[model samples]
Structure formats: structure tokens, C-alpha cells
Target: MINISEIANEKIKEMLAAEETPNLFLRIGVKEGGCSGFSYGMGFDDEQHEDDKVIEYSGLKVVVDSDSLKYLNGLEIDFKESAMGGGFTINNPNASATCGCGSSFRTATEAGNPAADPC
Candidate 1:
């Protein structure tokens, strides 16, 4: 299960309020081709595909596809507000390496595996 901090909930709420769709979720996934060979993908999704493991926290829906769930399960998500500005950050114990930009990551076992970005 993934945990979401209060800050993360607030940020998600703000995003949800701005969306016109009634059904939405914070969708997380992985893609290839960051400096680290794989990168994290995060965004708002309104649809849930078959085989997605959906979790709810603070009235917000969070979805992880079956494939990405292995790499993202047990993650702790929070909203960070520092001099660098504000954004949602994922503390993933599964990540073996992170890119220089800090936005990309790859797991030890899955490193170098090519998974194209859907976006």
C-alpha cells in the first residue's frame, strides 16, 4: 500500500477541484529513457483500466497499473514546499538509482529495461 501525507492530500484536492471530470485519480507509472534509463510518471487520470490496483487515501484515488505496481508499491508520497518551489515527491524504497534531475529513477532489477513513455 502507498501512503500519502496530508500535504499530498491537499495538493490532490486542489487538482481534483480544478478538473471537470467527476472521476479522477493520481496515476503513477514508469517509463524508459531518463538519464537513469527509467523514469517515474505521475498525472491525473479519469479512467481505470483492467488490472489496475487502485488505492484511496483522504478521499483521493490513486491508481497504479499492474506492471508498474511492482516498482511503486510501498511508496510514500508527500507535497514538498521549499525554496525550490512546490511539488509532489515520491519516496520509493524500490528505486536503486535516481537521475541527476531527481525526477527520474530506476530499480536495480529493472534497470536498463526499455519501457517507452506513453505520453
Candidate 2:
């Protein structure tokens, strides 16, 4: 399970209001290609695959695939707004190392293995 802040809830609500249709959920996953080994991905989703792990939060649904969930079991999704504007941020306790951009990260045992990357 992951933690969601009230700020995050507000951001998601804004996104939900902007959509033309309802039933859109946020999909969080990890992929590759950074100085570190893995990168986090987030998108508005309207579909759920067979292997997805679905969790509901504040009338919103968060979905994660089985493989991606393994690496993000207890992560938190945060909404941050600063001089850089606003965006969804990730707080991953399992990460031992992260790149300067804060997009890619690596665990203690993995180095440069880029999550879900074909390369």
C-alpha cells in the first residue's frame, strides 16, 4: 500500500475535472533509462489489465501491474509544487540510490539495470 497526501488528492481532483470522461485512474509504474537503474512513470489510465493490482483512494483508483508492484510495494505518491511548478512526486523507501533529476533510482543490489527497459 502507498500513502496519498491531501495535496495529492487535490491535484488528482483537478485532473479528474479536466477530463472529458470519468473513470480515469492514475497508473504508476517503473521503467528504465537514467543515471540510476530505474525511472518512475505516472499516467491517467482508463483501463485495467488482467494482472493489475488496483487500489482505491478518495474516489480515485490507483493501478499497478504485478511486475511493477514488486518494486513499488510501499511507495508513496506525492504532489509537489515549487519554483519548478507542480507535478507528481514519488517517495520510495526501497530505493537506495537515485539520480540527480530524481527520475531514476536504484536498489542496493541493482546498478544501472533500468527498470522495465528493453535495453
Instruction: lDDT for model 1, please.
Output: 0.79
Model 1: residue 44 alpha-carbon error in angstroms:
0.9
Q: Pick the candidate with the highest lDDT.
A: 2
Worst 10-residue stretch by lDDT in candidate 1? 110-119
Which tens-of-lDDT digit does each residue in 1-119 have in candidate 2?
77788899779878877998778888888875566777888889898899999988887788888888877978987888889798877888888887767787888668544462222
Model 2 / residue 2 / CA error / Å: 1.3
TM per candidate comes to 0.84, 0.84
Go through the candidates in order and give each one's C-alpha lDDT.
Answer: 0.79, 0.80
Error of 1 at 117 (Å): 18
Give the per-residue lDDT digits (tens) of candidate 1, residues 1-119.
Answer: 78899998988889889999887788988776676656788899888899998887878888888888877778888999989798877788888877656677777776546552222
User: What is the lDDT, from 0 to 100, of the residue 40 in candidate 2?
Assistant: 85
- Output the lDDT of residue 55, model 2: 86
